[model samples]
Target: MLFNASQQWEKCVKQIEERDRLIFVSVYVLIFVAGLILNLIALVVFFFHTKTRSHTTVYMTNLAFADLCLVCTLPVRICYHLGVSLHQRLCEAMGMILLINMYGSIFLLSCTSVDRCVAVCFPMSSRVREVRKKAPFICLGVWIMTVGASLPIYFIKPQLPGYQNQSKCFGSFPVYGTRPVAITSSLTVGFGVPLLAMLVSSWGLLRAIKRSQAAQTDLVDSRKIQRMIAMCLVIFLCCFLPYHLSLLLVYLHQRSIPCSLTSSYNYSLMVACLNAMLDPLAYYFTTETFRKKVDLDALRQMWPMQSQSQSADHHSRGPLNT
Candidate 1:
């Protein structure tokens, strides 16, 4: 058994082939073009075309920005897949930028979920106001922390034994060393934590609806939020989840890394890039959120017209104040 295992471990590392290259280039190009157009439109609409800049708007804008940054990294990856010679340092930078912004997008969306939960749970609390005021700071902190965490990737030496073209970043990470650890950490902190946070937010929203007297009026609110939450889950499962899981598998396999595993990881990663394309749905959901607050600024307009309508009806039919 030990001899067989050793033989397996000694199998030759998979090299990039025509099918792998074709799939990689095709998917990456689609993600790049689609993500670029989508994110740019999101940014434009979120920034210049609208007013009423509430915190949820802030979150969605930051999300769009993060997605744009991630989209920018795809061209470099596509270049690598197309057999263009790239410096190892450039490869490292591209990887780190993608890692940083991917987490940035995840964290920002988690913030949106948490913010929505807080707003729902404490509709009129002063703390909610405070949290809204701190939105920019929270986004700042997410960017800082994501960049800091990914800074270590820059320190990872480009060279690994038996690989001469360091630019062939696909084969760069060793199976047993720091790569698996990084993959595990990202799977935990990057994807797992955010997923749990979104679920908790969903639960909080459900609980708040149950406890409120105005659930009928807030049904739209609940539905919109539920749809957004479902979209987030879909993005995670289709994009981040499989990519990270396959990535961990490829990085941890002690035996010869199979072409199939590498292919799976590559394809899933391209799917992950589609999160940018899907993020516009979040903007649509949150755009109508908390809009009932201010009259004008970039994004936010409101779900609470029912409350105001009921109040107006009571005032109009009951009496004209002296």
Candidate 2:
């Protein structure tokens, strides 16, 4: 009887493992394709549309650049998951690159939100131009900060257990009797501080927009600005907040939780992959330039026929038609 029960448990575990493997493969592929395509389009559009290049465009450009960097790191992760043979050192390097890009992108998005808020609140200030001019410096600072924050991962050696004859790259930290201070510190600095900043900046943007609306001046522009701000805030909240919260919880769990909780943590990590794909859609739908580009592309498609019809109409008319 005990043998039969054990067999049944083993069968259940196998089924669960198979399901998780399938889920991971499907989600990662979708994230890779969608993230790469959308961000590429964003980069192209932002780069070519000179008229669209404003202070906000500068922020969006930096955000897109950061997201592109993040997408570049996905294939390594996909390969790792697919049972590819990778050294532990390689894994740590890939993990560090991923961390830097992810946190950097989030920070840039927060900066974008703050920039929009300032633009909305103080439209006439000369500081708007200053903000636009200094964007390059801000972007440089974001990159430096992200890289600096992620530097510690390079020093640790991560090992993959349970994989036979395969080296796995993961973040190695000193385990102090079930306590992981290094991991906790990394999460706090990378995800926690950035998330808090995003929330605060988003809140300030929302409040400023509300105040402007109540003032009954620049109503149309204010409405448009409000829509844009709301869309950005929604994307940040829906796509990112849960991911960071999950990381925080996982960090706390690692200190005193059972290994069984890792399945839930992995699920949360997977959900975070959705953000990269969703961000491009948010920009496309909210930004006026994208709409105008779409409109022009649609118009160009009809222009040849419209021109031919007009020419025929002119030929058919008498001289008096002039």
Candidate 3:
């Protein structure tokens, strides 16, 4: 009987290794390379290259920083997948940084949407414009809060004694042996609330845009508003929904279900990290000033003489007016 049990355990371990190790390594490598490059570009462009300090720029700067922080954690994760053992404290710290930045990205992305919604809905309100100046402080608060919230997870260690290999890092962390509460709370706070906020802001933005269009309010840039709403909706659907659903499946698996979502969970997580790459696209496509600055910089670099000659001509061109 003992021999049979050991054989079954070895089979289970082999199956898991065969199913996930390659996938994890491949996905992490892709995300790490892509996300690292994209977020670094975004950080440089948004932080130092651009001259604008508008509300959109503020939130996007925060978002870029958040994504950069998250992408930095990928190497550690990839090292773990490649069979490099890490100290428990280092693993926990990496996990905390990942969660903190992931949630920070979610919040800042939502903030950018809200900023657009308010600007559109209250186009003539000086008060709304006044509140826009508070964006930096708001972004600071978000970073602090997310970091604080994720810190507790560092203390919630895994208890998978026999499955020691799986218990390291984020694979089987904050294990829900009997207490489902922790996972539920994390799901609600980390995923559900952010998603709901994005949906609400998007809906409100759409309504405001329509109303302003009907009233012929020229104060709001209808195109910009549409772009913000579209980006938020796409990120929520593509990056967030699948990962959180996989989390739900994982939770259900912990409750003794016969479902095998381990691969699903890992792949969905990779999908989530793709947001770090996709965000630069959002900045390029949706944020007009950022796009213009990037284009002008590219032109300047590619043709220094022509850019210097046309600098005065291009100086007065508004964002996306071209």
Top lDDT prediction, candidate number: 1
Model 3 residue runs over 4 Å out of place are 1-14, 158-167, 173-181, 213-228, 257-259, 289-322
The TM-score values for the models, in the order shown, are 0.78, 0.71, 0.75
**For residues 160-198, what per-residue lDDT tens digits would candidate 3 score against the true structure?**
445444434444433432246656766787777777877
lDDT of 2 by residue, 172-280 (tens): 2212112356456545765667667666766765565454323244323445655666676677666666655655564555434433444444555566667778788
After superposing candidate 2, which stretches have Cα over 4 Å from the reference?
1-17, 158-166, 170-189, 213-228, 289-322
Candidate 1: stretches off by over 4 Å: 1-16, 158-165, 174-181, 210-224, 289-322
Query: In candidate 1, where is summed lDDT lowest over 10 consecutive residues?
Result: 293-302
Model 3: worst 10 consecutive residues (lDDT sum): 293-302
Cα lDDT of model 1 by residue, 34-109, tens digit? 8888888888987997656667778888998999899899898888878787787777788778878888988987
Q: List clash counts for every candidate, in order.
A: 7, 0, 0
Provide the global lDDT of candidate 1 against the true structure: 0.67
Model 3 RMSD, rounded to 1 decimal: 9.5
TM-score of 1: 0.78
Per-candidate Cα lDDT values, in order, are: 0.67, 0.59, 0.66
